[model samples]
Target: MTTETSPDEHQQQEIRLALSEIPSRLEALHFVTADARTPATVPNHQGRDEPTSIFNSYSPHLDNITNIALFHNEDQTPMPSPDEIIISQRGRRRFNNGSSPDSGSTPLRMPFQRTPTKVPLSTSMILRSSPRKRLTMGSTPPEPEPTVMPSPTKPRQRLWRQGLPPAKKLRMIEEGGKPIAQLNEETPLSLLLQGMSQQQLIRLIVGDLVAGDAETELRLRTRLPMPDINPMEEELLHAKRQIFRSLPTSRLCKKTDSSAYSRAALHLNEFKRLLTAHTKQLYDSANWDALLDYVTMAWPILRATPHWDSATHNVTRRQCFKLLACHCLAAVKNGGPLLGMVRLQATDKNLRDWARDFDDIQSCQSALSKAISKGRATL
Candidate 1:
């Protein structure tokens, strides 16, 4: 050169040259992007002074290459433009509408603020409900909850009315043939009851049937105290007699109506009361002889009573026999040699065969036999 160029002028000339190459480079980029699905071939757009090729020097994709720098090399990574750099420095950029970064119409965005939507609280709660957690691979699953079983309920018990005769033909409820005791006549009523607890008095009245006269019966019906009569074995015996007298005269059959069935049910109810209250007392006191006597008296009556009904099962009769067998079993286990004598008498009377009538009683009978065997061993 005839004249030496200044440093500032030289820089200005290089910038102009690079600016002039931008249009052609951009055109080449658009052409490559437009036909990106097909393989791109090198373009012949570079000037003779520029020896290197853009294809050999840079990646083909616009997303992988940036046009911000005036110079680039084979190993150089892409850098953001001025707008992208500014946005990136501020925060992550969000597009209001989903658009590519190359789209000129797409504006540089700041971080978006999430405003609350105008939805009801209930609706929002439903929408925001946490999703069920998914089990991951190789993780153990949760154990299932234990299965609860319902307990079997007892069958409904039949009710017995006061003073109702066992048979339609019988005129009145029998008070057994035994006379009411007059031993406590000199004692005050309070003193007579003083030795006994309230529970004992209640058991005597409700269970023992100590009341023998019409006045006593009336008071009992009215839930009044019968301090006049003392609790005695005589009253218990009379109650037992009343139960025996109440046994059904005939079995319930197809010809039997509702009213007849009802009367039979009442009789069974009385027998239940005898088993629950009076027999329990006899067992508790270890009154072996009296217990044997009642069993002897009851066995024949039970054998005579109706064991089945066409309209219903023989549950009541079966339950009564089961109670008798249970008492016998308890006495056999606890009463020692006395129960052996009772069992011998039962065997002579052929009463053990009666156990065959009820499944529950058969079980008790088996237990009774085992208990008797154990008692003999102990002796």
Candidate 2:
């Protein structure tokens, strides 16, 4: 009977077991001589020693000797390398044909064809594969149709010149529809006077007739080149009062009259003369604010000039009519209910008559829009 080993002896045994794992080259001896029982040598035939290596450094027992590539599995089984293991597994899978010998079964080749993704094939010509040659919808083609770019066209015009079909008439209401009395050309010359600009005024009355913005109106009235229109000393005072009356108790033009009425009158007369005489020029050298020294005045004179008509025997009374028309328009400005801020006639009669007379008044309202539509004028 053996007794239990001491701890020191046990430790020694464990050390020996661990040392058995060391990897090393082995020098194996092979006896090439005849069997010892027969003889050491046969007379004509010599015995030779030869060695064939099956295990040496590769031995599992001696794995610990160098362990240049030491590896451990969970089960502690020795495996060569990750790449070699993968290769071995792949080989095993390829060898499996799903048939057993005893069953007398035929090895089955799978029906579905497997296609491996290939690296781009290298060749001198560099031609495409068969799939590339075929036109599949999802696949992009080599040469696409030249994307036809549509020609850029200009924007179309909205309003046509020929005009549109007539609109249906609308019925009017009773009390609300009761017509207001229409104003006429007698409305006021001054109505056109408000809101006009200096540039408009310097131009001829023919240009003024274009019916521009309100600035044009004011300029025509107040700054027009007519020095003769300056009121008398008392009259200028009255005119200022008139302007105040024209406005509601508020919003009157400030009195430009420096010395009450007389000085203001003189100032106005000079201003009128200055504007009317030298409109084509900018301004004459004069002390405009020198206390109403009336160097000139607008003498509201009327004269009928005679001109021979080459076409007709009758002398046309054109000047008379012109003067009358001008004076009448002037009257409207001087006379007032003065409703349309300075002197705009808002009455239906005045509007319609103006539209008829000018042939341009109504057209002007639509004119700016039409010009924009046609690309004639810029926004």
Candidate 3:
């Protein structure tokens, strides 16, 4: 027996059948519109034409129906009409030159390849291909080429002169007992005095005398030998020797005696005075040899003095002796004595204070002792 279907079941079966016909319906629509002359229609299940009223109920306008077909009802905008679609298809076919969609190939002819366009050559390219012409102003002349000077050629030596010495040779032989060439000949005094006023001539004469004196002094100093034992030096030496002998004895003996200390002080003063006077004489006379002897003999005596260990008084006493010896040597070597007592006093002060900051008094003392030893060795 056949079971009766419900109304809902019948509606469901109709929807399934409609869905199954959708693809075929779209295919038929495409085929009808593919040709503009064909009439557009909806076909029934028997492939017979159905009236437009059936589709019109779903969409009132043709544009709305096309939109629904193209966009599956997602978009509401109207689609192009059949004539516009036909015109667009015709343009695309013309551009592609009848190229097949399945052939997987592009059109051979490009619009840009119709005719080759000539591009203008750039300035650099033109310059590279051809020589550039310089533009000249009216009546202006071109710059002249620079003139090159020829290099100087050295004189060629003759075959015979190749091994010979130079033309201008330095003379090795001295002329016997003759005065050599002088650049300036000596002028006579009378001619020299001819153009002078009284004051000018006096000044000239004074200057000549002074120059002569200085020249004579220099000659004498240079030519004279160092004196050995002159009478005055001998006397001084004798006095120095006597003082040396007395000084040490007095120091040893005066350790406890007040009277002995007084006597010793007196002797010390005398010795210093004698030393100063002797040093001055030797320096003024330029008696370096005798000065050397005196310094060497007195150095030992000065070292043995009672004041040598006294911090406050020893500095002055040692400075005095050092100044005397240094000044004498300086005068002997430096060509002249120091100018003033002020400089002598300054020397004494410097000798006492020099290098005291670094506790380097021993270095200064050793240098002075070495100078005395050197002087003695020279003598």
What is candidate 1's TM-score against the reference? Answer: 0.32
Residue-level lDDT tens digits of model 3 in 299-377: 5455555543335444545665665557544543443222233333333344454434223333344444444445445
Q: What TM-score fits each model?
A: 0.32, 0.16, 0.26
Could you tell me the lDDT of residue 299 within candidate 3?
53
lDDT scores for all predictions? 0.55, 0.35, 0.50
User: How do the residues 177-215 of candidate 1 rate in per-residue lDDT, one tens digit apiece?
Assistant: 532233547778776677788698778885668556677
| Candidate 3: 10-residue stretch with minimal lDDT | 128-137
Residue-wise lDDT of candidate 2 within 1-379, one digit each (tens)? 9999999997777566435432322111112222222212212221344222233324463334223222321323353765664455444235444464643343322222122223243534443545533333223446767898987997787664457765667767565554222234565656655546766555746454635767767775676442333444334344334433333233363332322333244433443343344321212322221111221121112111112233231122232223233333333333223222222222223435534333433432332233233432221
Worst 10 residues of 1 by lDDT: 129-138
lDDT measured at residue 85 in model 2 versus the true structure, 0 to 100: 49
Which candidate model has the greater lDDT, 1 or 2? 1
lDDT of 3: 0.50
Those runs of model 1 whose alpha carbons end farther than 4 Å from true positions after fitting are: 1-257, 311-313, 340-351, 364-379
User: lDDT: which candidate is best?
Assistant: 1
